[model samples]
Target chain A: MMNVWTLFIPELYCLLMAVVFFGLAMSARPNPRRDYFAALFMAGVGVVVALACVRLEGTLFFEAYRVDLFSQVFKVMLAMGFFLVVCLCTELNGIEERHHPEFYLFLTTCTLAMMMLVSSVELLTIYVALELSSYSLYILVPLRRGHGVDVEAGIKYLMVGACASAVMLFGLSYVFGVTHTTYLVEIIHVLPGVIGTPAAIVGLLLVLCGFFFKLAVFPFHFWAPDVYQGAANQVTAYIATASKVAAVAIIMRVVALSGGSSKYLVDMLVTLSIASMTLGNLVAIVQKDMKRLLAYSSISHAGYVLIGILSMSATGYASAIFYALAYLVMNLCCFLVVVKVSHDGSDLKIAQLAGLHRRAPLLAMALMLAVFGLAGIPPTIGFTGKFLVFAAAMEKGYVALVIIAMINATISLYYYILVVKAAYLMEPDEELPRLPVSIPTKVLTVALVTAMVVFGVAPSYLLEVARAAARMLM
Target chain B: MIVPYSHILMFAGILFAMGIFCAVARRNLIMMLIGVEIMLNAAGLAFVAAALRWQQLEGQVFVLFIFAIAAAEVSVGLALIVYAYRRTGSLDPETYNILRW
Candidate 1:
């Protein structure tokens, strides 16, 4: 009994954090400093709690939720993501000061929901958990100050998200009708057997749609650029990093349900992956707003991650997991620069990044490395992630797919270099004052940069952990 | 049990399509929300029919959960719609394209 309760500690801790923020939100006046410190402290503690529970394994809620290495590892990643995003909230200029507490509150709830989402093994539980996280984000997007665009983005996100979930639910009904079971454990046994049937195949594909929407896969990716540009930088960062990580975990789980048997499923996924890569990269080249560019880049990363998942092997799953973690770290580094550079909370234009090398040398360096990492340059975490994924696909004889992905990677380098050029070589028409870099941010930048390089250079430890986690899925 | 599972599924599928059509074709935000609600309820109808077909309680239970979630979704959706309305003074989605590329 005690052990079962221990498996839930991380989520419970996040709930407590949400409650604390909720209380703070109810206070008469909002003190941004107090809220920021409280959120940072609580989020830090949440990370510790998640890490402490990473080794505990059990089932809870009548086995609707499973706690295993896979779920636990994702929990730790989600916690870390929440903490890092909170660190960027030190200057929450994008949102109104009074809305600060609510911002932290929604972020906590969203993190908590994602933790539940990763652990849930029952279909109904997954739907509930996914919606919980989506709702939190839907609210958070519009909380930005002085922008009708935020509300517009929020509504679009809500509409599209609602439609996707509806399609997912419709699909779930078919899955239930066909399998007569909601438990993933049971579904896994039954689904692969009938996977050749139109009902089973269509149901499974439709189920993947909800997660694909979350991941910003090609057909479901229309909202990314606008939402990333309209929402506050911090909210966009949370969406880009933490939300994406959760989406990858759930999609992998759902895709694994096919047991790698359906040729049609593989073909469909392959098509989507290739399309996402091409469309995302080609469109990203013309983006002027930094966040919008990252949004399109995120679409392509989704494609890369899918290359790992569609391989449908333990190595594939492990590589996908590794890619997700690598993405989180490097993407955070980019957003950190975005947040700091756009201190006034306006959308950052690529041209505005001109002379960043002089304005804040450390940030410029961080942005360059992070952007290079994103472009899959050698000796960076992104490159290592792409290598692992492509290798996994190659092992599965996806030769053409891997070659196309490599071409996409090369095309991606063009835009990423443009960003670095803006930061390093392009001169500002008017010399701007140097950005004020705080001590803690400097430490964070150094830590993130080191992690990117060190992990990229030697990924053996993380790969082993990812492999262990992947084993649990099979 | 008298109604074939195929018939029920066909009915639910039509309803679902109708909902989707409303969501896509209607220019009004409130209508779009209604369309989503209709789609959800259509799914719920299928779940209930599925429950009857399988003679399992899980499907019916899932419908209950769906109802609760749909209610929650509507509350949030309406709040967002209201907020957008307050800001732009129009319920048309076309009017809310300030964030276009």
Candidate 2:
């Protein structure tokens, strides 16, 4: 029991925080302002607990959960992302009238579940944790009141999520049908003898489909833009940033577990990567809503990360992890601006960004930094991530794929720059809201933007850290 | 005589196809919920079939887990459906064009 205790301290903190915050919520008559602090405090405790786990590394609780540098780094990153999300969400004066308390509870619970997901080494553990994360989002989406888009978004997300989970379960059954083992290490040992079978490949592809849906890659990406545009802006940020990070982590873990590449899987992945990047960028060109644009951008980014995963080597996995970290910061920064500038909670349209420089100079500047970083421009972490991934692909002699990604990266720049131009170059039509945001949001935004630039310039530090973390996945 | 994996997969295939059709074709919100439930059961069937075929613990264990998650999903799905019906007065998704294509 002590082993389980140490393994799940962060989850315990989150569970306790939810109970306490519920008590606070029930007694305090829905103090939106106070509850925000409750979220921050819980997230802070979570991060500390996650860090403490870093020092104690071992397989615990019958090897269902593994605590190591790999899990530790991701858990801490997730906790911090949750903390920032909580801080950023505090100012959502808009959601106060709705079921806001329930919203915060599920948000915290979902983050806890995703943290568990990265640590789960057993197939059963991973399945349940994935569902835990999904259910929370199903509730959070419709909790947004006064908008039909919110309800619609919630339903769409649920339907697609359920289907994906089903596909994954079906695939899991196939794997079990063949291997008789769900322990990843054991499964890997057995796979070389059996994975060449057609049923095994079909199972693999089905499971990959489930993951691709979460990552929002091509053929499974139809739900992304609608869900992004229909949901509240902050909710969209959670889906695009934190959700993608978790999905990418799982992809890398599963890929590593394969030991080496299967020709079938590699060929399939390369084709998917090419399609995802091309379609994601080409469609993003016409998006009017900022959230929709970011949705497609994230899909393309997933494609780039997939290129690294396809490399099926240590450097490939490390670069993918590094790119995910870089994405978590740069993409969150982009959405932070969207949340900050659209204070009244109106979905930001490309046209509305006109004259942002005049309305809020500092925010516009932050937006520029984030967008440029996303476009993979130098002096931003996005460039560093893209460089490492492309180099890894080249190492694998995927020359055509690398060239395609470069062209797509260049194409992505145009749309991202369009947003910046709208912010700085266009003129406003009316007197904009001169909003004074709280300090927590300001701090969160600045932290992400700074991380983006610093990581871009001197990437070796984070790069080496990612490299070490990737080595542990096997 | 135990059920074969092929029979189970056939049933699952039929159920899955039916669920997709109902989810896509039905205008009633409750029908869509039923479709999702059917689809979920189909997935669970796959696990059960695989467990019997392989004589392994993992597949049946997966089925048990899916049942647990499916229960949770149904509750939430029903709640959202209720909310949507109360607001829209009908489950016809064609009317909810408030979302962009």
Candidate 3:
């Protein structure tokens, strides 16, 4: 009983934090001030506290929610990401001052929902958790001040998200009708027997559609670029990193339903992977806006991650996990620079990065490392992640897929280097003064850059953990 | 004995398809929300019918949760509509493209 309670500590803490933040926001009188720093402090503490629970394992609520090695590992990654993002959000200039605490409230709620999402082993719980997170994000987008684009992105995100979830629910109904059970463990036991049937295949794919939307895979990825560009830089960072981490975890969970040898699922995954990589990389080449460029780049990376997932093996799952963590760090490093550079809280263009090295040397160096890592250049974690994922695909005899992935990588390198060149070689205007950087941001930049290279060169510890976590799903 | 399970499923499927069509075809934001509501209700109807056929309480329970979720989604959905309307002065999605590449 105590252990069960312990397993729930992180979620309870998050809920408490959200409620407390809301209360603080509501009760403030003449000052009308919300403690943004406190919000960041709580998020940082919450993640650190969550990290301590990595070893505890239990199931509660009639085994509907699982607190296993796999879930805990993902939870730690998510919490850490939440912490870093809150830190990065220290100055959310785009948001109105009074709404500061409310913003943190939504952020915590979304994070809490994601925490629940990974732990849920029941279908109904999964849907509810997904909605909770989705709704929170829907509200967060439009919170940006008086911008038609933000509202537009909010509406598009809401409508598309609602449609996708409805489609997913329609599929879930079929899954329930076919399997007659909503618990994942039971479904896993029964699915292999029925999965070869048309109903099972369709139902499973439909269920996957919800997660695919979150992951921004091909057909479901349309909202990502627009929303990324429309939302605040901090919100975009949260969406790109932490939300993506949750999507990867859930995708692994759902795909595990097939029980090892579903060729049809493999075919579907292959098609999505190839299309996402090709389309994402191709569109990214012409993107002028920094956020939109990163959005397409993220979509392409989603494709690379799929190569591991579709392999349907432990090595594949582990590689995907490694890649997700690496992607999170590299992407956040880039966003940190964007957040700092866009001092007025407006969208940034690619050309705006000209002479970043001269404006701020540390930032320029950090951005270089991130772009190099994203482009999958060697001695960075991105290369290691891609190599492992591609190797996993080859192990599964996906020769054609591997070749296409390589081509996408080459195409992606072009745009990534273009940004680097603008940052390093081109010169800024004479009048604009040097960009100011506080001590903490400088420290974070150093840490993020160092981690990218260190983890790339010596990935044994992370690889072993990832392999262990992947084995749990098997 | 009164109604076959296939008929219930067929009815639900048609309802769902209609809901999807309204959602995709309609230009008005409110109409799209209505379509989503219809789709969700169709899903609930299917779950209830399946529950009756299977004689399991879980399906009925799931429908109840769906209703709760659909309600929450609608409230949020409407609030967003109002928010967007206030900002853009129109409900048409065509006019709201600022971040296009």
Candidate 4:
């Protein structure tokens, strides 16, 4: 008999951490420094706990929750991501001092919710978990100090998120009415017969909109640029990387419901992919703020990830997973630079990167690696990830898609290289002070850059792991 | 039966559309939140109707969860709106546009 306790170790750890943080934050005159360190320590423990749970396999909560290799892999990755974001953000200067511990409380809760989301196999459970994560993020967005932008970002994210969920719920009701079950496996069994029906197709597409919103796909991507620019740098980094990984995981799971039965679904995905890439890349070229630029970049990346998803094959799914994993490191590398260079917890512009090579050589190196990787330059993980995604689409005989993706890649290079040029070629102010980078950031930069190059050079191992995870859905 | 299932569904659909309209057209944050509440209630109504149509309890159980989640969403949402109002002294979203490209 598998005890429910065994299945919930990671969640329990996260909940405990959240409660401790909440208690500390509620105390009279909480010290931010102490709470910050405590939060970091808890995240480190979370990483260990999540890693330890990776091999446990069972079901709990009357089979609504599953513990399997697939969920475990994502849980471990999300925990590590949480740890990385906490480590990278040593200070909470952009946030009000009193709310610092509260921030960690929300962060832990969000991470916990995502872990639950990955394990949830029932529709209602998934919806509840997603809302938990969304509500936490909605609160976190507006907590930025001294900026009206934060409030705007919060309201926009909330309203849009609520609308998307409402649409998704209505769709779920249709699905439930048709299938008479909310369990994914049962729905998958029933979906094929009904999938050809117009109602079923509409419900499936509506269901995808919630995740599309989360991934910042076109038509649902309006929140990304605004929210990215408005939120604090650390918060932006979390959204850009970790939350994106969660979105990718959930998307893969949801799209798997089709089991490659419907041509209309493929067509829909293809159209969305093309639009996302073309619009995301074209709009990104004119962005002045670094965060906004990356926001558009992420949108385009979401398009590229869709290529693998649209392929509807195991290889395609694996490539998408690999791409998301690689994106986590590469995008964080970029935000790490942004966080360091901003210095005063304000928004950073493209021009601010001028003479970064002079101000901080290591930071400049990391930025160069990240941008080059993002541009799909060779001998970097971005190139490897994109190569696999494109190859997966090509294997499916999507020649036009491949060509369009290539064009978008080429178009993206101009803006990416522009950033690199600004950093390496432009001169610093005559009296500008040199940047001071802490030990943790230096270590993180080196680690991320090394991972970028190493993973690019030797992707077979990661590919194999990604294949196994993909196989679970198949 | 007191009402046909289609009639209940039509009523829910109209309520949902109106809720979406209010959410999109309104400038006030509190009004937008109310719109969301109305939309959620529409979902609950549909769930209840489905339960009666199927003579199954699962749909009713689902509605219970929906109520719980909608309450949670509203509580946090209202708190956030209050926080924003305190800081900005206004509820109009247009005035909060400090991060435009």
Candidate 5:
């Protein structure tokens, strides 16, 4: 019994943190500093808790939830993401001070739900956990203060999300009908043999639509740009980083069910991958809002991650996992600059970053490294990640797919360089005062830059761990 | 079993189609929410039929989850709709277009 409790430590700790924030929210006085400090402390402790349980392995809840390296690694990532997003909440001006505790509460719950999501091995459990996280975000999107567009973004997110889940549920019913079992382990044994049938392939593809919505893949990507632009900067950071990591984990799990036997599924994934990469890169070029540009770039990155997942090999899965970690760090680095530069919590236009080098040299340098990393330039973690993913695909005899992805990478570089130029070269029309750099934020920027380069140069250790985690899926 | 699993699936599929049509074709936010609810129920109906066809209790249990989640979705969806309605005084999704690409 004690060991069982240990298996649930990370999730239980997150729940406790949520309860604490709930109590804070119910208090009469609105204390932003107290709320911020409480959140920061709890989230930091949450990361430690997740890391502490990384080596423990057990099944809980009658085998519905599995605890293993894959889930634990993602839990650590989620906790780290929560902690970093809280660190950016120093101003919290995008939201009303009175709503600060509630914001933290929803974020904690979302993180908790994702923790559960990563551990769930049963279909019903997966559905419930996914819904729990999505609902929290639905409420969070509209919580931005004084933005009419936030509510609109919220409605669009809710509608598209509902439709996608509904489609996923219909597909789940079919999967249940065909396999006669709701356990993924059993389905993995049963699915590939029948994957050639129209019902099985259709059911599996429809099921993927739900996670595709979360990851902002092509057809389901309509909400990302609008929501990212409309929501508070911190909220966008959470959505862009942590939620995406969870989505990638689940997608890898679901795609693995096919067991690499079906040509139809591979063909379908290839088409979606190409479409997402091309469309995301092409549309991102014209975006003026920095967040929207990141949103489009995220859509394209989802395509790249899909390339790793669709390969259905252990190396492929490992590379995708590495890519997710790299994305979380680099994207957070970019958002850190955005949050610091837009200290007043308004939407940041690309042009607004002019003279950023003069205003805050550290932030500008961080931004440049992050953008280069996103563009997959050499000597950054993002480059190493993309290389691993493409190499995995190449080993699987997908020469054409890898070539197209390379073209997409080059196209993506154009916009990323455009962002770099705006930050370093362009002069502001009016001279602005040098932006104040808080000590903690400066420390964070330096740490992120170091991690990007260090991980890029020496990926063998992280790659080994990712390979171990991917082994669990097989 | 008596009705045949294929027929049940076909019926559920039609219901699901209607739900999708209502969700996409309707202009009012409330109608769109209702459409999603209908889609959930259709899936639930299919799950029940699947339970009988497979002679397993898992699919039946899954329908219960679907019902509960559908309720949760409706509550959240309605709350968001109500908030948006108050802010803009319009139920038309087109009116709330401040966030365009």
Candidate 6:
């Protein structure tokens, strides 16, 4: 019982911090450094709380919230991810300050929401948690002033997000109507018996609609390209990485809880996975904006993660988590370079990176590594993640699915190399400004870039953690 | 109290679908934002209907959270709408295409 109470401390602390940040932002003289310090403190406390939860795993809050190895691992990763985003955000001095600290306040609230989401053992709980994370993003997206693109992006995200969520809730109601319970464990208890029923199928699809939207899979991914292009660079980085990881964790939980897969469910998911991969990668090749190119690239990567779910095996789940972690590093490295390039208040463009190598060799090299990793080139974590996810699919005899994913993976390299060539081989548009980055950001980028490279070379530790998480889910 | 939840759900669903159509089909930004809010509220209505039908606590619990999210969404969505309107002085997305970059 004592452990059960301690399980909620991270969430409670963040919630309290959110209110405090909000009040401080409204009442006091503006100090960006203090605000960032406060954010780091909140993130550090969150990390500690997540560690404590992992150390004290037990059913808590009437079993509606889980505090098992799975939730704990996800919480730690999410906390660290938020901490990095805060580090990147603290340096955004160009963003005009009209209620500035609200940024950190909302970020804390969003992190609390994501932590709740991973621990959720009920459909309704997940729904609320998903909304909590999204609402924060809705405000955060339009934070870029003098750029109507940011506003456009926010509107697109909201419109799509709201629609997908409604569809999800309607589906949940149907599931509740059929199962006569909202508890996920109970839902699992009853799923095998009603695997082919219309209500179950509709309910599950509806639930998936919300997540697919969040993950930006095909058909539901229309808003992503626009949003990525329109949002501030750092905000785009956070949205592209952390937002989707939380969604993937929930998707993994749902599939694992549903007793692997039925013919109908697996069949539907395979189609979605294949379509998302093909469409996202193919569309990404034509993109001119640096952000849009990466956005579509992310969608393609999302499809690969979905394929991981389609395997419905421990290896599959673990690989998906591993891949998500890889995607985080690769996407952030790319965004860090984007932030660095635009550090002097210049436009963020693919062509603008013509002579980055001449101006900043290290930045150019890091960006190339990120893109190559994204393309799944050799000796990069992207390759390792892709190999594991596809290998898991093959193990489960998803031959057609695996083959389609392989084809998509090979096709993705062209576009990724296109970006790399532009950075390295393209001629200069003048001497590129020497981006003056804070030491913290430089250290953070190096760390993220190192994680990507090292994981590709030696993935045993994260693989073990992913396996532990998958076992807990099972 | 068989308020005919399927019928209520269907009604909300149709309204929600219409809202989506409005969002996708219309070019005006504010209209699209209104459409989004409507869709969210429709889901909220479905949640309440299910809660009442089942006499369960979860649906109501979820609805309250949805309301909270909807409130947050509205504040920022409108702010963006106003910003777009100010820059272009027209809510037309075509005019706002300065960001195709």
DockQ of each: 0.84, 0.61, 0.72, 0.63, 0.89, 0.45
Can you list the residue pairs that collide in candidate 4?
A: none
In angstroms, give how far residue A284 of model 3 lies from its true place.
Answer: 0.5
- Tens-place lDDT digits, model 2, residues A105-145: 88777887888888888888988888898888888776665
lDDT, candidate 6, A1-474, per-residue tens:
665677787788778889978887886578777777888887777777777767557777677888888888888778777777776766675455555687778778888899899989987678779888988888877777654677767767877787787778777877776676889999898887886888788878888888999899888998888888777776787888888788889999888766875887888889889899999889888888898888889889989999888889899999999888888878888988888787743347788888888777778889999999999986889999999999999999999889888899889989988888888999875665665666777677778778888999999999999999889878
Cα interface RMSD of each candidate: 0.8, 1.8, 1.2, 1.4, 0.7, 2.7
Distance from true location, Cα of A372 in model 6, Å: 1.3
The residue ranges of model 4 lying beyond 4 angstroms of the native Cα positions read: A1-3, B1-7
Question: Tens-digit lDDT track for model 5 on A3-60?
Answer: 7999999999999999999999999999999999999998999999999999989999
Residue A459 lDDT (model 5): 92
Question: TM-scores, in order shown?
Answer: 0.99, 0.95, 0.98, 0.97, 0.99, 0.92
- For lDDT, the strongest prediction is 1
TM-score of 2: 0.95
A151 in model 3: Cα distance from truth in Å? 0.6
With candidate 1 superimposed using the best TM-score fit, by how many Å does residue A77's alpha carbon deviate from the native? Answer: 0.6
Model 3 chain A worst lDDT run, 10 consecutive residues: A27-36
Candidate 1, superposed: residue stretches over 4 Å from native? none
What overall lDDT goes with each candidate model?
A: 0.95, 0.80, 0.90, 0.88, 0.95, 0.81
Each model's number of backbone clashes? Answer: 0, 0, 0, 0, 0, 0
Candidate number with the higher lDDT (1 or 3): 1
For model 4, what fraction of the real interface contacts is kept?
A: 0.47
- What's model 3's overall lDDT? 0.90
RMSD of each: 0.6, 2.0, 1.4, 1.5, 0.7, 2.6
Q: Give the higher-DockQ candidate: 1 or 2.
A: 1
Decide which is better by TM-score, 1 or 2: 1
